[model samples]
Target: MRTSANPIIADLRDRIQHLEGSVARHKAILPFGVPEIDAHLPGGGLAYGALHEFAGGGVGTVDGAAAALFAAGIAARTKGKVVWCLARPDLFAPALAQVGLHPDRVIYVEAIREEFVLESFEEALRFGGLGAVVGEVVRLPMKASRRLQLAAEGSGTIGLMIRRWRRPTEVGDFGHPTAAATRWRISVLPSEPLPVPGIGRARWLAELIRVKAGESADFVVGACDVQGRISLSSDTADGSGETRRSVHSG
Candidate 1:
């Protein structure tokens, strides 16, 4: 004979499942899946409930694009939808897709100013339903950054802040301190040598300018692939256990 599940037991099971999911989300870490990089990061990857910052090495468009693609690749690896808040309307969806973040997975919010962009970014981070929240701003004051950081920590959603500058002098702003868990700089580099006389995969000089409780380092990495996966250059992948080290802090 078939018997119905007890209502009380069913309700208890549902509650247990919800708790488990919440715990997992709180403990989540998005790994780059590259040992060289992961080994240096705390918890072997980026903590889910944290804010990270990225900037281009130069004020040029190419370096800025590289920084954006780097963030896009990281967002692509995450689950759920991504909210991207930007003051500029020049985001290239096709390029993002090339780096593995498809347009379908993103909700683009074009704000009139950086303050508005930060507002949208904070809201998305607090909502917690999205996979990630990204905001592009020229500068992130400590007060504004603290608010975003708290929101992300409460919701267990990752926040990516891209620092875009129009003038070389503006690059000095990145040196200011903020609440970001880590700060990175990406610069375009020559592609790897190809077997034949054709262009090869793009590369970048990825500098870990600052990381929470960790020393700064730099790596020459291949550009994100179609699946949004990045790999260490052959020099770093040969198991020599070497990474370019620099002294810096957040």
Candidate 2:
């Protein structure tokens, strides 16, 4: 014998179940520009509230510059808000603008030490309104990384750590424990236009060294125009009858 109130209670439960399923589906999709990389990331792109880390190659200046460009592009597309915490005062303004991220849209926090940088990063991640926060650090402790991860999750913001090492150490080696949902190693590749002169476009080989949710690690993607625009590379014969290789990746 069902009470008269039973039907109303069952109806409310069904509505709650439907809402839960909708939220789950929304959580499962993240959109990164590159189809290949998106395929590897857990939710397609970087999850809204997760930490991602990027380690520089042996060379700091070039690698750091590239990493900044990449992070800036992601932030620009995020459309919420972006913050960049730098330990070093010399962040190339022109280079950052070239990556499609307007300089005005960024908030820069200059920190004196690595610890301060990480601490600031955690605070920013916990703030809840930013679309993404980037911190430049040499190495992050596993515990600290986990805290940033959880903070990002709680606030619905993406956190990025750019690992910069001064000396030749295995700090950015292939396998390492990090709280980052995904980790990438970025290296500069020789630009195209072989046997020619002039500053050729920069090329990068991005490796998905560690991913919390993804398949395959080794993949190559080009860092197109610095301003975050994607361009295709073409090989065409110049009027001089010379076959030169041109590089383009958008």
| lDDT score for residue 164 of model 1 | 97
TM-score of 1: 0.87
What TM-score would every model get versus the actual structure? Answer: 0.87, 0.76
- Cα lDDT tens digits, model 2, 123-198, are 9998978867989887788888999998887677888788776665645442558778877777766664657778
- Relative to the true structure, how large is the alpha-carbon lDDT of every model? 0.90, 0.70
Cα lDDT, model 2, residue 124: 94
Model 1, global lDDT: 0.90
Worst 10 residues of 2 by lDDT: 241-250
Clashes of each: 0, 9
